[model samples]
Target: MEAVAKLNNYPTSPRKMRLLADMIRGMEVEKALAQLEHNPKHPAVPLRKLVVSAISNWKQKNEGGDESTLIVKTIFVDGARTIKRMRPAPQGRGYRVRKRSNHVTVIVDTK
Candidate 1:
């Protein structure tokens, strides 16, 4: 059995989030949480929250499920949108700025 959780509109770029997600893929739930907790990257906070949400989903779906048996089967991050803005530059020129966002999904399943 598997359970999935998603974090939408996260204020980080997809490329950055994917790097953190890759580290925890196929890892046990507990270990993944620990790794995320200690990670120095700012993206770790959202990833940690996402993992916890996945665990909660697993528990809710399986009333008698043992958490110790669960593992992070897969994790993915995808680009959502880039909010475009204009910033004033030197010489009366305007520069385009893109603020990126991402969507993250994590799946957990029992061993």
Candidate 2:
């Protein structure tokens, strides 16, 4: 059995979030949470929260089952739409500004 969780519009860019997601791929649920909790990166907090959500999903899917048996089977981060705007520069010039967002998906499966 498998469960999935997603976090949309995360404040971090997809590139940055991908770095953290790569570290947790194919890891057990417990170890993934531990790594995220101890990591100093800004993206860890959101990733940790998503991991917890995925665990909850697993628990819900398998009633009365042990969460310890669940493992993170896949984690993926994708680029979302970027909000673009123009910033006025000196001497009547304008610069394009891009505000980035990301979508994160985590899937867990039980042994």
| Candidate 2 structure quality by residue, lDDT tens digits, 6-81 | 9999977999999999999998899999999999999999999999999998888889988888888999999998
lDDT agreement with native, every candidate: 0.93, 0.93
lDDT of 2 at 85: 93
Model 1: per-residue Cα lDDT over 39-95, one tens digit each = 999999989999999999999999987899889998999899889999999999999
Best by TM-score: 1
lDDT of 1 at 22: 91
| Clash pairs, model 1 backbone | none
| Per-model TM against the reference | 0.96, 0.93
